[model samples]
Target: MGVLSICFVSFVILFLISLILFTIGMNFLFNDYTIFIEWELVSLNSSSIVMTFLLDWMSLIFMSFVLLISSLVIYYSSEYMFGDIFINRFIMLVLLFVLSMMLLIISPNLISILLGWDGLGLVSYCLVIYFQNEKSYNAGMLTALSNRIGDVALLLSIAWMLNYGSWNYIFYLQTMSGDLEMSVIGGLVMLAAMTKSAQIPFSSWLPAAMAAPTPVSALVHSSTLVTAGVYLLIRFNILLVDTWAGQFLLVGSGLTMFMAGLGANFEFDLKKIIALSTLSQLGLMMSILSMGFYDLAFFHLLTHALFKALLFMCAGAIIHNMNNFQDIRYMGGLSIHMPFTSSCFNVANFALCGMPFLAGFYSSDLILEVVSQSYINMFSFFLYFFSTGLTVCYSLRLAYYSMTGELHSGALNVLNDEGWVMLRGMMGLLIMSIIGGSLLSWLIFPTPYMICLPSYLKLLTLVVCLLGGFMGYLISSVKLYFFNKSLIYYKLSWFLGSMWFMPYISTYGLISNSLVLGGTVYKSMDQGWSEFIGAQNLYMNLVNMSKYVSSVQNNNLKIYLMFFVFWIIILVSMMIFV
Candidate 1:
């Protein structure tokens, strides 16, 4: 422990303080209470811009959760990052990230939100590239640029809000409801949320971001960065309900959820599999929120944050011991060598599958029950249930291959579970994963939802869990020739193993195509044919007209007088004839 460790300790203190404040805020929830702090910046004629902070139960509680995960991540990193030259630098960036999240939580005005939003993007880019390697650099670019799309969308939302004569959108949620301008704002905001949350087209960057340090991934993927969009939707759910935008969300987020789940089943890289799980969980939150269940989405967000952070931490510990090996095929029987991490991993996998009263069960179980009660289309119903089923499928697969299979990482590796600092971090979150659901369910939903789901729907989770477990055992234990299949089958495996080619389309296809098209337009039109027909032709015409004028200007007074005399004679003759 050194100065860097001490700084992490200091941040841990700050997080505790924020948590206490949030706890205190719960007393004011029923009063419809909000605390607003503001300072006027400048006045432009009728409009005055001011910096404002809005503190409510929602913001405070969410901030508390974010801080809690961040503080744990910092503490965990003290050992994970121990003895590194730039450990202090990494800690500082994380602290800055926490600050940005807090700022985002408190802001009421879009301008203030931008301050935090942009801060998150910039700091995330810095953290993702902290390793200073080519892979990290490329991943950082993809992460930053993908998120920039949302930042731009947010800015456009702010621009659109200018038409309403205010930046405080909270006041206009109901007052300006159904206004065309507001619908446009809602659409833009939804687009922004999609990009931030890695829904649909923006999905590639989430898993790619696993190139960052594990602690960073634990914080970013599990809680802060991905959930930011879901949180924004929760805040704006009033405007989203009963809108076409919400339906679009239902579809996009559904596809994202199922896609990520399928991708996780194919992925073998340790961190990336977990990363895809995060993407899938993100999709789940977004999809549920789209159905007008904001509180359920938020509940799952917090609970998911607890277990997923623990999951990443466990993965980090295992990776740390394995000498940076991320392929689970190269790992097995890890529970024998690293019991604590293995236990944490197994518990997280169970919780993720929504087993009984684990943290994930409270929210995910509720999502399934509520979704079953609704009059959803078959497509939505299948996406939701199948995605939920797939969660169990992949999680069971991960647990089987990584924890119980024959050891393939070699016998002389000298792996040990003696990293107490890492184990301490996992212990904190493991307890939460085990019991956080019951506690959060009591706290957030004091009056539990009375679900009227059918018997078949009630059995759906169990059926899925059993089937997923059996399939996982079959896939891992049996010698399937998935690799030696025919070319047709091989192509199908490649398609899914590559995340439905989304990474290719979004990264290489979208970017390369945009650049190539832009270059073509610049050469063939802007610089070539358009130049010939536009500026060049106009310049030539202007020059020829000027030459004719100059030619007519030579000794112009005598010619002008002769013309004037001839016109006067003609006018006089016409007057005489009249």
Candidate 2:
């Protein structure tokens, strides 16, 4: 507790200094000056590997945000994890996670970036399993292996970029833009990003990772870990903007967004619901970035970080108060007990639903407007609109069950809206969540986006949002008495609750198939025919030959010599005949 308390203050102070420095540097972007800190690690006559760190406005702004959120998370944990013996380990892991993110942000070189990328994956795995429970172990394996796919893809991208004769990808992103080798590299990078960002086929891990401590979830899902992919794409936007892979990303991100909204509606775990919302937002960011809105995506990335981290902090407070209870069915009318936390949670939820004037609206509204005006197909349009509606739907449902509904239990409360350290952390983000969006828009885009759309399309978001919110409230308002009542739609409800069976697909479908195939191969080759013919049969034949030689031994020298001379004559005759 003492050490974490000290770390909380130390980290907050350090990142505040960084935020000031980076804000000043943002004014100097027009100077054509970049600070490059480079050192040679491996050198040869023909080729060499070097670690290069590039600092520009983009890197500075991102690093500053990462440090800020990370510091707040540390401060929040000072109380969230108050009496845990491993609190020191937790703080150190978080600091290491921040360092990895900083490394990823500043390094333009692919090899140097790997150090950060792999570190994020490793540290995240550690964080996910910090509780050392069975659920945490499973979640940790899923998180680590899924991210490992991206790490492998990145290594492949590096190998493909070797044709440029250097691992310094930043130096070649422009010159090799249209080159075939670079195209392959760009495609691989997109694949890597998909896995990291929790897009389809690699998406279940994001929600499952909620088995981790809430602070870890807040950090991993919000700014540092998942956002790494979007930041990577932003850096490599020059390469992806004109490729087939970009189109692939657009379609996939749309699906991911739609899926997240759909999943959150049926989810009951408070933290998992928030995790799903994060996934939906990630999908939005990836889709827009694919459409060449690099700055827009980056803007949302920043604002989302501000609120999502706060949202998790709010959830952490609730969970702590409830003695680690998470099911929303077990909670209701909590705002009456924990006013400060409930207010922050609702504000973050409103921001998540893109309420006007809040942090989510600036970027989300712009993204929708841009999609509405762009030459996108009808399928993409429907995805964006319906996903938006579902966001409202699920949020309303969450707010009802967790904040405004009748109390479901009679448990005594230990504390309410009174964790001063925790409340301070939430307040820090509360200030940002209120004005961060519009403020960032002013800074990042001096000119407002001129959205030209029919009044009908412009109101589409509002209409769908209302309908979804009404549906959420209406559904929650109805109580189903099911003690002896069989649900006819039980299967349908189960499907939606199970994230369209994604966990089943990723866990049983893919993993079981691989294991079954591996077992088949092992049985047929390793333990069966191959083992017998290669080793067992050879040993048996050698033993038989040895037995025959041993049985032919003689006791007398003369008899042995007579038999040896006869056998030699017969052997020489047979050899001559052959």
Candidate 3:
């Protein structure tokens, strides 16, 4: 069969599967938990494999979003990757990746959940390396290796939990407690989460991951692999509730959000900017989820998947026209030529900037309100508030560079609109991004449909968003560079960007000392101690005996066998005597 035939078949299969899952999930959509056991994998007397489904308002909502967006990304890839030799392989991996994420959402067991989790990571890494370029391979290595560190901590925590309680998800919830040590384990698990979610010290790998194709970026950033960490926390919310670890995570998420938003403000590469923005957004979601607002966080994840995927797809179309170049400086005034992509890009960006009536506006507004309700420490308060400013600063920068600036004209025809299939996908997502947020009241929000925040806070958020858009406009108009004269901003960006190097630096120092110590120890053993008379004499006796035996060697197999037989008899007799 042709690649197109196979691709269409795969999409149809996935579409049918998701529709069925979506129906079942929606059927069980209550505010409380409902568990449907597919098969009993383990019991006291026997063990077997089975499938299961668990649903709540949050899981069902996010599952529906994952299935919907993932199906679109798959279809987008078909046309986007047409005529490419590795299209079939890429499709297979993508299908598996989507499958794993869906499985993770509905998993009734932590072990099964993790199986899906690792599968997503593995498949993402594979997709990162799909282009078979050196840079792609290196980025894939860093991304995979960094996530591995987190995965180890997760595995250890799960092992501890399983030993103490049970492996089943509901039973694990029944076993949940706020023990001090369990909080510590929770902290470790959050550490794993921070790494996987690309927070603070573990965040450098995310921008590096821009070497992947645009669809892969869409896949990673949009509600699938990158959001899994936040989903994990939400899945185990029973255990994480009312713990110091939860508090710590709330603070960690705040910091990550601010840092990532700031980083995206000055990024030159279009995808890297989105990548950093994603990190920050995930951080915000983590913070919100940590505060027992799983519904809000998952709703944000849902909207983010829609808008961000739209953003990346439009950006992908731009890059595709530009012969795969991603520099923001080289792209400008593209709205005139590629009207559809440009329109989608602008709508997505507006939604991303949290404009009212758009998806990001509702989700981000909910998060900010949740933060206000949950703030306890002065530190947390400052971080949460400050991150709002950075979020505006960066999201607007993406808008300014791509739509309104002076075009870099050196590369002729390196700028064009995407084909019908790609544009259709972008337009669909754009519409969803605009209207999806308002629907949250009916879908994921715990409260009824109404304006939910205070008037002053709403004003403040609107002012911030407008001010950010204006600031981006001014900066782009003048071609203002933050690092040119601003030493403080430079230092801050450097600090955040280079934070992941600490461990490698420490390892370098330790290895240097260890090598010096090892050499000294070897010298003493070889030159100083062995040079002494008695030690050298003892060593020489063994060496000389081996040398004397060497003189008795013969080329003839018969002679060697005769001597070997004689020694065997003597050795047997000695063994009997002993």
Q: Which candidate is the best by TM-score?
A: 2
TM-scores for the candidates: 0.87, 0.88, 0.83
Ten-residue stretch with the least lDDT total in model 3: 499-508
Residue lDDT tens for model 3, 1-578: 88868866765666576567556655666435575657665666565656676766556667767767776777777788986998888888887888888788878676787788789779889888888898888678777877887888878877877666555555555455546665555666677777778876677677777877788789789888888888877766766667777777887788788777766765788888888889888988888878777777777888889999998898888888877778988887788778888888888877877877888988887677666555467777667666776667666676677777568757466556637778766766887888888875555544663445677765666676667667766656555555453455766656555433533442344334655788998788766776665678888898999876876674668778888999999999999999
| Per-residue lDDT value at 466 in model 1 | 80
lDDT tens per residue, model 2, 1-578? 47765776766685786688567557744454578788888999977667788888788877878878888888888888888987888888998999999999989889889999999999999999999999898888888878888999999988887787777787888886777656888888999999999998799899989988898888887899999999999999987786788889999999999999988988889999999999999999999999899999999999999999999999999999887889999888888888889999999999998999999999999889898888888998899889999999999999999898666765574648879988998898999999999888887777677888999989888888788888778666665434322256778767777777888898788765876899999999999999898998999999999986876664668768888999999999999999
**After superposition, which runs of candidate 3 have C-alpha atoms over 4 Å from their true positions?**
30-33, 41-57, 449-455, 479-578
- What is the alpha-carbon lDDT of model 1 when measured against the actual structure? 0.86
Residue 414 lDDT in candidate 2: 64
User: Best candidate, lDDT-wise?
Assistant: 2
What's the lDDT for all of these models? 0.86, 0.87, 0.75
After TM-score superposition, what is the CA distance of residue 245 in candidate 1 from its true location, in Å?
Answer: 0.6
The local lDDT score (0 to 100) that residue 195 gets in candidate 2 is 94
Better of 1 and 2 by lDDT: 2
Q: How accurate is candidate 3 locally (lDDT)?
A: 0.75
